[model samples]
Target chain A: MDNQDEIRKIQLVNQLDQLETISRFLDELAEAWDLSIPFVMKLNLVLEEAFTNIVNYGYQDNETHEIVLVFEKQNERLLVSLIDDAMPYDPTIAPDPDINLSAEERKIGGLGIFFIRKMMDKVSYQRMGSNNVLKMEKVINP
Target chain B: MMNLNFTEVNNYKVVQIEGRIDTITAPDFESGIMNLMSDGVTKMIFDCTKLDYVSSSGLRVFLMAQKNISTNKGMLKVCCLQPSIKEIFDISGFSQIFTIEDSIEYASGS
Candidate 1:
């Protein structure tokens, strides 16, 4: 965590429309770091899934809320931390969807979390005060 | 943001999708494809050559469409998936569920 290692953070409103903005911000960060297209795409997918879950189910009220994302590059791994005050939820504990099941019998609710786990090297969740804190790490193979 | 374009080729409905299909655009993607079911479209090919990305939400939409088409005794084929997008499908086990081909012609033939 060098002071000059380009730590980027963004606060997005809890709305589906903000997905595009989040993607742009991440793309900029990835570009600045010279990350490969495949790596950036995978990171983008992981972030989208997590953010979508928070926007769709995190808050119970009709008002707007802020979801924060922090990104950093550490040695051979990329680290991303998400902080939201919407609810108390731990996606890491969710059961992995049975990928072996046929398409007709497969369930859709859990694939988002399951994909995140499969794409990232490590995923950790914590409750800090009133916010749900999630951290994910992915090793840069290239 | 996502864009879907459809064309008819030899009695097969070919759909070319572009841009990202995340949670924000998946519902529209689902309904757009499902609407074709009403037209009695039995043979379909999805060309993903221009598709930039697909998340879990997108996968759900594809799965739903495949199931619906199967129920109607139709065949759904996907072709020209970019490497990364194909990787997502492979990781999700969707590669086993759908007929994925290398090109539009091959998909149409199948």
Candidate 2:
């Protein structure tokens, strides 16, 4: 767990259609690792938010961009790292949505990052060599 | 990969959603709900029993539908969410905003 030997990685192009492709990859990972239903669901949720953000707002041009995701299991926790060569954006520091507001008054811009924060136990962001690296971890204990 | 089936039950429009609602399918989902609202169908219940997954985009659609229904003086309820989807709703605090029921009968009645 301390080494990178067990890390699983998937690379994708920055496109909305790639969400399904990445989701299938996660499903395979879940089955291979015997991940619980809730765990897999949460991971998928986080992936969708992070990946969609990169695809929708990360690029200024229409050209395709690369997005890399790495998964690692350490002790009782699962760590996921999403790396993209898009704009330098840190979702960890994004504003939390005001969930206390009524449905009519609620705004939608920040809910994705907010959900990512709420579901994951730990979330860290770093700009590494022109890549926006977002790392998230969740406890996977039964 | 999402399918939305709309049915009328006791004068309430029930939208049964299947498959995953993510960034790609959220626009269609939003427009479908908006179509219902434009058609003057306000009393709605979203049946999420067969919905495998939903991301933040889907939540935004739900919020928009709720707001539209409220402005029209209509009602909106959701029923039969899977455990995982329910957890997302709970985390987003949607459980407090929308009336959620265990069954469509309860949702329609309420």
Candidate 3:
């Protein structure tokens, strides 16, 4: 909570159609901060994967919910925070598939989190105050 | 968020893709191509002129299509990919495996 750190926040409605807008917003933020190309691509993928899951799976019974995304930059690193009041489902608990499985034998789902874990430098999740909070960060420079 | 359109150009199956090709829509993409393949149409060209995004999943579908077409001795060409999607392809070394062209005419050989 330092005054020197920069923060950007956007509130998203829980719908599959809003995924693209969220990604575009993130891209604009990245450009404004002069984020590198590779870093931007990686961050864009993570945001799309996470938000899609939220829009598809979260609030299955409810028609609407609010998803808040916050972007902060510090020390050449970008930290993205996603807050949603959907059901309590932690991506980390999902089982990781055996990479050795052949294409035909492998299960279809659960690869999104695995890809996110590989692409992003750090990812963490928590449930606080009836909200699911996911925080991910990437270092654009050494 | 994939903006997709299909057209027949110069006797070639052309799929014009736009916007992002991420996890959610990658499966739809794979299915779309598979539907065409199942109909016994093999020679295809992907016109990516307006495509602005692609994830590894999207790349995976391309790899799968390459394999399918190779087994059948059919040609699968990609053309007019924008910088963002092309960057992903280049970084992942897909430029070597697929026949990518600057335009659909080049890919169609006409």
Which parts of model 3 have CA positions greater than 4 angstroms off?
A: A1-5, A100-102, B1-18, B23-35, B43-51, B56-110
Tens digit per residue, CA lDDT, model 2, A23-65: 8888888776778877887888888988888888889999988
TM-score of the B chain in each candidate versus the native B chain: 0.96, 0.97, 0.94
| Backbone collisions counted per model | 0, 0, 0
Give a tens-digit lDDT track for model 1, residues B15-98.
999988888888888888988988788789989999999998899889988898889898999999999999998889899899
> How do the residues A1-142 of candidate 3 rate in per-residue lDDT, one tens digit apiece?
4645488899989886686787678678766787866577777777777887887788768678989999888867878899999888787677764555433344436656665776678889999989999988888752
What TM-score does prediction 3 earn?
Answer: 0.71
Q: How far off is residue B100 in model 3, in Å?
A: 9.3
User: For candidate 2, what TM-score does chain B get against the true chain B?
Assistant: 0.97
Two-chain DockQ for each candidate model: 0.82, 0.84, 0.20
Native-to-model Cα distance after best TM-score fit, residue A141 in candidate 1, in Å: 3.3
Q: Report the interface RMSD that candidate 2 achieves against the true structure, in angstroms.
A: 0.9
Candidate 3 chain B weakest ten by summed lDDT = B87-96
User: lDDT of each prediction vs. the true structure?
Assistant: 0.88, 0.88, 0.78
| Candidate number with greatest TM-score | 1
Predictions ranked by lDDT, top down? 1, 2, 3
TM-score of chain A of each: 0.94, 0.93, 0.89
